[model samples]
Target: MGRPPGAGAEGTWESALAAHLAFRGAVLDVAGSTRRLSGELSRLGESHWGIAGKAAGLFVPHVEYGQSQLRWIDDELAAATRLAHAAAEVEDPDMQLALLRLAGPRLEAAMMGSMLLAVWFDFLNLTDATLSRHLYSVETLYVKMERWQKMLEPSMSALASLEPEQVESAAEDMPALVGHLTREFASLLDTIHKGAKVLETALVLKESMEALTMLSALRFSLPAMRPALPATLGVGLMVGPNGVMMGTRIVVSAEWVEMMRQLVRAGVLSLPAVSAAVRIQAGHVMMAQGHGDLPRGVRDALGDAPEVRAMRVTGKSGAGMAEPPRHHVMPNEFREWFEKRGFTGKMRIDWFCVTLQQPHHQAIHGGGNWKLGRKWRGEWNQMIMKALRDAEVGAGRMLTQNEILKIVAGYMKLYDIPMNFVRCRGK
Candidate 1:
């Protein structure tokens, strides 16, 4: 007589048991890395610099949270390892299948926990390095610090919502439950990865802007010195190698013009710069206390030109004595701009990527074909089928019809999978 519907194939079950053992070994390596990172962070926290000291203190809570999760994962992995070894020695298909089912959730929880912990570990390390290198007094650095902290909120919220207990409770079919947990955990990891990238990009931009602001100030001030200081600051800003001519009209590149417009649209340029530009274009100064009035004055002054058009003409042309644009944003406008981009949204991986690479893409589709290529689609489908087969073998049994469908649905949600492909076939 044929075996029961959920019965395991002997060779496949054995191979599955072996795979679990290998996975347990891999988890052990992750545990070692986590421990080392935790130790390194602890050492860094003992440093003496005030800023580093403050940042280290703030980072403690996140490290503690990660450590706690790591401990839980370690326990789960230890237990799973024990169960896998016992299953490997077993001859009965039913007994081995039962052991595999029991180990599944523990393994899933450990894997998810490890991934979440790694995200925090990486964030802490990056924050520490950034804080150590730059002073917080600089406006760009301060803004970068604030942005990093704000970005952590969503990640922390996601981490807190991770319910490993749910994994155990909901996992009726081991393979399907493992698949579901894998998808959910992967989605969370991707979110955290994108968030980290955003923070990194912010830091880079902050550093660049700080240098630009300093050089621009020096460029304007140095030339006005009594003896006229050497034109060191004019190296990049000046149109000629001889350095800037005091009363000569300055010329700017088309690229510089485009960049100023983008910076204005992003709300990163200072209100004072906008005000000064408006004054220059309109031939009269406006006493504006806030950004609302500044943008209006600018619009009226420039008339149909881009909001930042004055900036292109301000410092670059006409005697090189024009006021250079400041790199600070008005607080209210920055907050509004941030919110409009849905920075607080639950699934912000797409938003985060767009913000880091092309801020303009947030409001509109960044001009790309949405259709998947036929070859790419075929490759994706094959990969999915392979994953499903491996999952079944690792679980030591054929997944139920409902369990298979649920796994498919989880993949669909996780990847926004297209419906045009053939349904996944099961062994």
Candidate 2:
């Protein structure tokens, strides 16, 4: 179809109202669905490994990557809502028309002028989606399929050694169950790929407000047209541009449920970094002793392993080099604030600390060369605090350690911090 007059110029009150509702609905839907999946993952991971344990730490991330994306969507929604309210409801249809005719141009201008395209761009979020996978890590199955298959090899071997009864106690068929999960992971990736096709198409349409122009045409034309005309084409074009949400939890969580159950049955129940290193050297015989915690010393030699989380360094080494300072990931100044909201005595402000590369640390705290007092809430901390506050309000409860870490991950990615620099939970 040919382009409409005033394309990208200004949407009608109808289109603006539709865009406001549709855009906000779509953003919340994607973010909300992602949040739901994050919990599903948290449950599966922490159920076996403890919330503060290694399963949660493998990614040091996971759903945490979405924290900022969720908050960013929210900020855009808030702005859109305020702008939409300018075209608020009234008792009379005639009065509503009069308001639109009089103020609609300015209101639409305000909405578009406010860089509302950012909301659409974020919705597309091709780059943001990739980070979600890497930090969010469900895509560990899909993207790191080879790595996952390799990791599962031990669990598979461990399961194979068991008697039929031992396997039956947890899994119906050992190899078959593992095969099912691998297939499901592939299927899940296929589903995402299908959704990506939709996203890619929308991204093309989004250039120069072409999608908005289509929405404007639909606002006037759809109701009067035949019912079977695919009315969803226009307004919905903008809603779920990324196609990354909805029922995703079902697939991702299902994969986790089976994988964890299989691992437990196989006696391959060691953590990825710490305990795995200790017990794997102790070998499979340690699995026979019971799944209780190992002694701290058998694990001490294991800390040097690369998967061991990076620690916050302090002061100087025996060599007298000035170590990069360890700073609290959640600023220490707000300890009381976080404590009140479940940062807790046990979760420990120290556990949340990161020792950034000195240059990055100095950059974060104002600058390396400039005379500096550092950014408010450490600058990074301020936005993180705001995002977490918004999350608590959205989630309707105090955030979990896992949840807080996810938010921090999201913000760190925003600052372009390297993933290796992220100081994980549980030291």
Candidate 3:
């Protein structure tokens, strides 16, 4: 019943850091662009002119830059808030504006807290993505290191057992091998040490940033303002092969692509339009028109069907309804395809697209419809298993639902898919 070893301290530190980051990111996001947290200062401090000019060689990508910006803003906000308190105490108008100005957006109040929140959450997303990739990369690297260790262990053992002449002969042609292994070992040590340093620096920055987050207490003490979670939806379309487009609905906390993948695995959603878009993108066929309606029509058709009607709709809409059109719920068809290929259920795979019928004029005043471009669905599990193996996660090992979902989400993040689309097997 005593606390687990080191759990209390670790938890407290993490909690503190999370709180600081959350509040800081909120303030910065709310204060868009005006008094912006520029990379200029950090770049200047580090003397990295390249980041300011070409914007290349950034340790993190644009998404990570957004996160770093949030961290900086959090630090800035804490500083400004402290100044604001001081100015208020001394009745210094300039100082007060300086503090409050840091809180405001460039030209619009809309740019304020809400935008910062958006960016902060975006940074969270980007961090999640990087963490996933890093985890996979680290895992792969460990495997490779193990192999290298095995090779080195045996070679060293053999060298120790051999006479001096034998040892010299074995190592004669591979003179560089000794040096290479030594360098590699040193490099690995450096990587571990530097990684720890980066983590420590991040923690220190969190502490500095936390000073600004305390301003929330200042606001909470005031009756006029209160903390609230801002709600806004940003959606993106992910098109897959054929005329299949998945309409991905995303929220700050939602993994849009992964959500779609779940729906696809459950057979509750289809993204033919997005699929068509990807096919056009991949140049599988000449660009064709009139495929946009397929996803929408499929949603409508499937909705009216008894089978679909009986299915539980996990998504919610403005009407407080649990289900809406599949397109609105899941937008990225490629994600759907990806998940389906990786699913492990007993569902038979259909590697065909979900196409819609378009209205066209026929002879004799009869109206007819034509099939549009296709969206391919199939035994996606087999395909995805290979990809997981290639990424060195070990395909032989079975994944639980959550692990599978995580991997699916990671894959989408790796590929920079705007949304994660998934569906379930048909009943």
| Top TM-score prediction, candidate number | 1
lDDT of each: 0.37, 0.36, 0.30
Question: Which stretches in model 3 have alpha-carbon errors above 4 Å?
Answer: 1-63, 92-427
Q: Total backbone clashes of model 2?
A: 3
Question: Can you tell me which runs of candidate 2 are displaced by over 4 Å?
Answer: 1-320, 367-378, 393-397, 416-427
lDDT of 2 by residue, 146-174 (tens): 44334334333332322212222222222
Assess the local accuracy of residue 87 in candidate 3 as a C-alpha lDDT between 0 and 100. Answer: 24
How well does candidate 2 match the true structure, expressed as C-alpha RMSD? Answer: 25.9
* C-alpha lDDT (0 to 100) for residue 126 of candidate 3: 23
The TM-score measured for candidate 2 stands at 0.26
| RMSD list, candidates in order | 25.7, 25.9, 29.6
Q: What is the TM-score of candidate 3?
A: 0.17
Q: Residue 116 lDDT in model 1?
A: 39
Clashing pairs in 1: 250-317, 250-318
Cα error, candidate 1, residue 66 (Å): 2.5
